[model samples]
Target: MSDPTVGQLADVVERTGRLIAGITPEQWSDPTPCSEWDVRALVAHVVGGNALFAAALSGQTVTPGDYADSADRLLAAFRAPGALEKVVTVPFGEVPAPIALHLRLADLMVHGWDLAQATGQRADYPDDVVEQALAFSRSALPLVRKQDGPFAPSEPVDLDASALDRLAAFLGRKVG
Candidate 1:
């Protein structure tokens, strides 16, 4: 499948970030379908994921801590006014632009649901973005299954009876 446009990915991240930022402190500490992670921790996780994705695009090897650090910096930047674009344009390589964009898009789309669950807010991401993210996850499902680490699941499964629900289920969240 073709990668989403950069504007689309940026919109996904921006819109979801706004939703997440609007959440209360209580929600930040609430549990997510990720099991071990709460909303705040999940935020950190997504930030780390972005950092790793950016680094990968830049042809650099990155550790989880690097992603966490990147995430921390991003959150701080977001808390400031008029910093969205700068924060989103974190340094990334150009060689594999499509993959990097997909990574960013999928991260925002899935985490948006996580944040919604924790905050008791209902959100719907763009259908095109959700569809692309689902396709991306499905493509990587097999490789993800071979790892001997803790993860919800990669194979597609039944879910909440909607596109968004299916997308969430594919990402290991039990949303109905």
Candidate 2:
């Protein structure tokens, strides 16, 4: 357990889950900074992602939003005995399970920010998350080739922008 990815995984998912649990029915229709996805769709994305990664971490096939307690289930799945060390069958290919967990940390935090922006809520993710996500995204950028891929090249940001803002910019998000 030398890597910090395990704990950060729980923190990112739990924080996003708590925020999503608080979303009112009205806010579901609001548009988010993610551009294409509305609040409800964004939530679905988070839940789906949680399910996918959780299933992988637990060495099972889990349909998205299949459980009522998606976030808690996600946390529990990763926390399961030997879950972290299990080999995950990802769509890309087989790799160490921890890499999958590490990838989720960046995805969840970004989507959490998307949810917060959509619903006019504040997420206050720790600075470490920002640091981790930025590093991950930077390293991952070279892997993305398609213009319509999941992420876009880092947009230009002012020097004063916070790390999170820079992350959003770097990930091709239009920061306001």
Cα-based lDDT for every prediction: 0.63, 0.74
TM-score of 2: 0.86
- lDDT, residue 30, candidate 2: 92
Local error of candidate 1 at 74, Å?
Answer: 9.0
Off by over 4 Å in 1: 58-95, 154-160
Candidate 1 clash pair list: 48-67
TM-score of each: 0.71, 0.86
**Candidate with maximal TM-score:** 2
Clashes of each: 1, 1
Candidate 2 lDDT over 25-70, as tens digits, reads 9998999888788988888887888887777777567778532466
When summed lDDT is taken over every stretch of 10 residues in candidate 2, the lowest stretch is 1-10
